[model samples]
Target: MSKIRITKEFSFEMAHALRNYDGPCRNIHGHSYKLFVTIIGEPKQDDADPKNGMLMDFGALKKLVNTEIVDKYDHSVVVYKNDERLPEMQKLFENIIIEAKQPTCENLVSDFASTINTRLPDNLSVFSIKLYETATSYAEWYASDNPTE
Candidate 1:
């Protein structure tokens, strides 16, 4: 059977800053972020299976993304654990999301992909991720496009 691809899109608001940026991005700011995740799998072969028609239920995908990413990042300040401002930011805000590295769009999309990939069910595989930091700006990551590995 041919592989079927399904994509789920999620939107959330988050604040982040560059660790040592020389310009305005050094200060914390928020973006209405958009995230798209693509998953691929082969459709069920047995016509008797109730789920035979779908790659994965949209509701199931939503629940997974909500628990893994949205609930963790929404309306939070995203800072690297080692960031100098983490303590100050935590003191000022009740919700903070920590990452291992600076929170740039490129880095974020990659992290998003990794997080989702790790939690996905064994039958599904992550194919790509497209994350938008702004209306006109976005970053994309594809599992198959990594040539460095």
Candidate 2:
């Protein structure tokens, strides 16, 4: 039993903040967020050909992220809490449904990882998600059996 992992990078710009934060981050700010989605699994038997034994197809992965995730946040202002604009987000959600705990990159990464994991083929499992809010700032989340305290 062998496992292979594949990652795809994506980016989108949006505005958000830590609601009620006592720090500067409390103010709404925008970031050109970068996302790294990792998928792991054993090779597909149907694609046993030497060149394409992996469970994932790069093109399919791209399509899943692009259509299901990136395209939704392209130029939207992401809010931590519900707002009047939620109706609009609701519309988009109808199609792609990318929602988060809060609009922060960390939360975004967690939400994305969970959502993608649910959408992936049964054999493919999501391992981790890394989100970069800026060149120097980022966060990571993984599927863990033990929750962090």
Candidate 3:
């Protein structure tokens, strides 16, 4: 059987601030985040299998991404763990994510890859992830780019 790539797109609302940055993005702002998750694997070829000829069920992929990323990050505010306002922000916001790295789109893609990779089944691998922070702006992470890690 030939390898196939399956992609699922997810969207969520999230706010984040870039700590110690001089740009306007330093202030807390929100984006209708768009996440594209691609999985690479060979389709199940066994005739007896219910999922025969399918690399993975789209519904299963939806559930996996929703549970792991969308459900948690939706309507949440993310900040660097070392941000001085973290303590105060935590008190004011019900959903806060204090990440070790600044919540830039680039970093977020890497973070998401780590998360999805660990949770994916052994036979399926994350081929790439594209996070769109805006209608025209986005960041992409490809497994082929970081062969050493």
The count of residue-pair clashes in candidate 1 stands at: 0
lDDT values for all models: 0.88, 0.73, 0.93
Runs in model 1 lying further than 4 Å from the true structure: 147-149
Model 3: per-residue lDDT, tens digit, 17-104? Answer: 9899999998889999999999999999999999999989999989988998999899999999989988889888999998999899
Looking at model 1, residue 56 earns an lDDT score of: 87
Which one wins by lDDT: 1 or 2? Answer: 1
* TM-score of model 1 vs. true structure: 0.93
TM-score of each: 0.93, 0.78, 0.97
Scored against the true structure, residue 90 in model 2 reaches a CA lDDT of: 59
Per-residue lDDT tens digits for candidate 2, residues 1-149, read 78888888988876665656679876556788888888888877665575467678888898998887788877666665544455665565443233445566767777777778778998887878888989889989887631431
Model 2 scores worst on lDDT over the 10 consecutive residues at 92-101
Q: CA RMSD for every model?
A: 1.6, 4.7, 0.9
Report the CA-based lDDT of candidate 3 relative to the real structure: 0.93
State the lDDT of candidate 1 residue by residue for 1-149, as single tens digits: 78999998999999998888899989999999999989989876778988777888888889998998899999998887788878888889988888888889999888888888888888887899899999999999998986341
Best by TM-score: 3
Error of 3 at 100 (Å): 1.1
Ranking by lDDT: 3, 1, 2
Candidate 3 displacement at residue 18 in angstroms:
0.7
